[model samples]
Target: MESKRVLITGAAGFLGSHLCDLFIKKGYEVVGMDNLITGDLSNIAHLFKLKNFEFYNHDVSKFVHISGKLDYILHFASPASPIDYLKIPIQTLKVGSLGIHNLLGLAKSKNARILIASTSEVYGDPSVNPQPESYWGNVNPVGPRGVYDEAKRFQEAITMAYHTFHGLETRIVRIFNTYGPRMRLNDGRVLPAFIGQALRGEDLTIFGDGSQTRSFCYVEDLIEGIYKLLLSDYAFPVNIGNPDEITIGQFAEEIIELTGTDQKVVYKDLPQDDPKQRRPDILKAKELLNWEPKITRAEGLKLTYEYFKSLTKEQLEKIDHKDFSEFTR
Candidate 1:
């Protein structure tokens, strides 16, 4: 009777950290890795005391070397947010390509199943309404968001190669917008951004008239989907997200209501290549993994708002005001 071991890259990130919790709770010996470029150690700090948990302060894009058997490799490392990828586009690209290369190699060496976290961004400005896994996507390769988008595309390409050529077991999950407790209030994603502004008693800024739409999945539901996918026999991609759709303007109102903040909505110009709509067609996930998001927006939002409220005064004040410049290459 031996415990399973899992290597979770970006284990300090909001999503990655949550995976660590889920795996550990399910009786797995977890090895967490992160460069902390955009991850905060505090997210995974509590797990440090667990006997079965360990962490590596290394960036996977550069090199990844882990000792002992690795039963699973969850490649969750990357600067996932626009602000993060914009500031460190090169790093994002490298992690998605080189970092994934390293992990695939590790998985092959250990004969372990690997799951790489892809994004809905792959279905860039998607021509299809609720993007099915079959949609090829409508992406501008040189656009501002292409760094993250293309990197993920490359990651998926190479991952499938290993599965096809090298015969390594693999999984890919196109994650939609996920929000929860450990979310950085300044990650520049709509959820945290709205929460931060409302917490600080500032007007919620809506870019591009807030007409653009996004679908949000609760973190717990997303983690469950990932977990089921890993153990399943599927090798292709699966969309893991809540299909409930809402516009930025409408979502802003929801946040204001949940937080009891009197803040009004303000508008700003939309950034280049921003998706007008994003909702996952999870029919494949539902059929294959028997998964669909269970957390309603109201329940999830209230929980997330309380988490934001529990932040320290200084953390609450740490607003990200860095002006982002697009990556042209």
Candidate 2:
């Protein structure tokens, strides 16, 4: 039998790069595309030497053209972090809208299965606890964070349209907070922020009294769920994340202990539109994909700490001073 050919946008990203590694290990011919807008080449630099791996430094927001028939297309190219999207809001919106449309067109041409990487942020400041896929989000249309959230919401809408109108095979995975090795230390997400602060011997900054809660899924577990969803027969968006909730304050303390740092807690005003709580109910994932997160928070954090420790002193310094205020604008 012939090997499957998989095309992944944002293939150099934390999750995308890991997906490439997994596909290559499974003997699939993998093509990774990234504009390197926020994705670092260093993440997939090692994979360049792999015989089954190929890469394209192209922006998915623009046109994407490829030869031959593709068996799969994973459209994951977009600015995921608030800091990134805030700085490049136009690009964020374009990738989710135009980029997804282009990829869907390509998938239709090749009769290939396509999976879009959606986000739990689609449920903006959601009212429901342990949010299921059935709940319509409580999103603010004109909020500062709306650029990214609404773009994803529109992405899902168009994806479903393609599936229903064009008869395209499509899958959408609503990713929650995911962290692990290869994550950009300066991404400005909560995990990296806390970890970077502790590593730099600075005060751990907690916003809004540190009472806001989030459920984190280790990268490995997230990747496993993504792979399962891609192969499953389901088409609607499914939540894939760990359901164990922890307060931001408690999470910061966990980082301090894990990093063996003596950093003290410092409170700051929470950013506008910051969600007070987030936890995905993965009953659909469990029932359809038979998936659950395997790596506990402690185990995932330790592994991530080791990866952060392996960075050179200069890289660590850069991450230490990374400005997060830009993400809010």
Candidate 3:
């Protein structure tokens, strides 16, 4: 029998690369795609030699063409971090808009199940603590973070449209903060930024008073949730993340202790529209997907620190102190 095939966009990225690994391990013919804009090839370099794994250096915002039968498509091609989306807002908007359009059409044509990576950012600076999937969100479409936020919001809308009007098989996972190996040290997210600063013997930078709250779900547990959601007969968005929330000030202190670096926490002006509180109400995910994070923050942090510490000195030197703005998932 022929193996199933999956097309994972942004496969060179941290999460996308891990998804590629999962599908390949399941004996699927994995077709990975990325334009290498913010994604690093090294993340998926180990899979290049596998017969079941192939890749295309292409952007989903443009035309996407794949040969042969495709059973699944995981759309994860957008610029995720604030540093990335802020730098290339146009491209960021394009992927969440044009990119998902192409993938959805392709999924329809191929009769493939499609899963999109929506985000907690969709609930922009959420008013309610522990945001649920039903919240309409409080977003500033013209704000600096709007490019990424609105794009994801639109992605979810269009995805639901396809599922309703066209009878497409669709799954949406609103990912919360996730940290692990393969994360770019300078991606500008709070976790890596704090770790990078600590590793460099520099003060950990926190925008605002460091009182804003965030919940982190380790990458491995996140991947399991995604995998289960893909196979489940669900069509609505599900929140997948750890709900053990912590304040930024508290998290910075935790990082300092974990890294064993003599760096103190420093504060700066928070960027406009940065959420003061962000956490997910994941009851839906638990009831629907039967999933919750298995890794504790302490265990996950130790593993993540070891990965960052194992980086070559050259890799470590590439990290420079900058604004450590937190993008909650």
Candidate 4:
């Protein structure tokens, strides 16, 4: 039997790289693509040696072209972190808009199933405790985080349109706070920022009073959920994340214990539009895909901490001090 072929955008990113690994493990011929803007080539360096893996150094926002038949396409090409989107706001918008449009058309032409990588930020500062897919969301289009949030919102809309109007096979996964190996230390996310600070023997910085809550799903668990969703017949957006919620302050303390380093928590002003509470109501995912995170925060954090510790002192120092007033809380 011939192997399935999958084209994954953002192939060098944290999540995209993992998805590539998963598909390759499942006997799929993987064609990885990335612009290398926020993506690091080091993440997918090991895959280059495999016979079934091929990579393209191209941006999807311009035009996407895939030779031969394609069985699947996973669109994960975007600046996900606040540090990234705030720095390159225009590119973020373009990828969510033009990039997705190009890929949907490509999927249509190849008659392939395409899955989009959406974010929990779509439920901006959500009023509900555990956000479900039915929530319309409260987003400020002109806010600082608007560029990325609105871009994802547009991605979801166009994807569904392609499903209904063009009859394209599309799957949307609204990813929550996911953490694991290969994560950038200075990406301005709470997990990496806290871990990087603890590694550097610096104080952990909390943007708010520490009342804000977030649920984190491990990378392996998230990748499994994504794969299951792709193969399932359902097409609507589904949330994939751990439901075990913890406040930013409480999480900081947990980091201190995990790192075995004594660090004080420092408070700062919270960024505008930063979600105060972020826990996914994964009932749909559970009932539909039979998916829920199996790895505990303790287990995942230990593995991640070890990965960070293995880095050289130079790598630790690379976590430079930048203005994190707009962190992805």
Q: What is the C-alpha local distance difference test score of candidate 4? A: 0.93
lDDT tens digits by residue: candidate 2, 239-296: 9999999999999889988988788999989988888889999999999999999999
In angstroms, give how far residue 127 of model 4 lies from its true place.
0.6
* Higher-lDDT candidate of 1 and 4: 4
After superposition on all C-alphas, the RMSD of every candidate to the true structure, in Å, is 2.5, 2.4, 3.5, 3.2
Of the two candidates 2 and 3, the one with more favorable lDDT, higher being better, is 3
lDDT at 95 for candidate 4?
Answer: 95
Please report, in order, the local distance difference test score of every candidate based on alpha carbons: 0.91, 0.90, 0.91, 0.93
Kindly list the per-residue Cα lDDT of model 4 for residues 145-195, writing each as its tens digit. 999999999999999999999898999999999999988887879999999
State the weakest 10-residue window (summed lDDT) of model 3: 320-329
Candidate 1 TM-score to native: 0.96
Between prediction 3 and prediction 4, which has the larger lDDT?
4
Residue 142 CA displacement from its true place in model 4, Å: 0.5
After TM-score superposition, the amount by which residue 298's alpha carbon in candidate 1 deviates from its true location, in angstroms, is: 0.1
Which ranges of candidate 4 are over 4 A from the true structure?
316-329
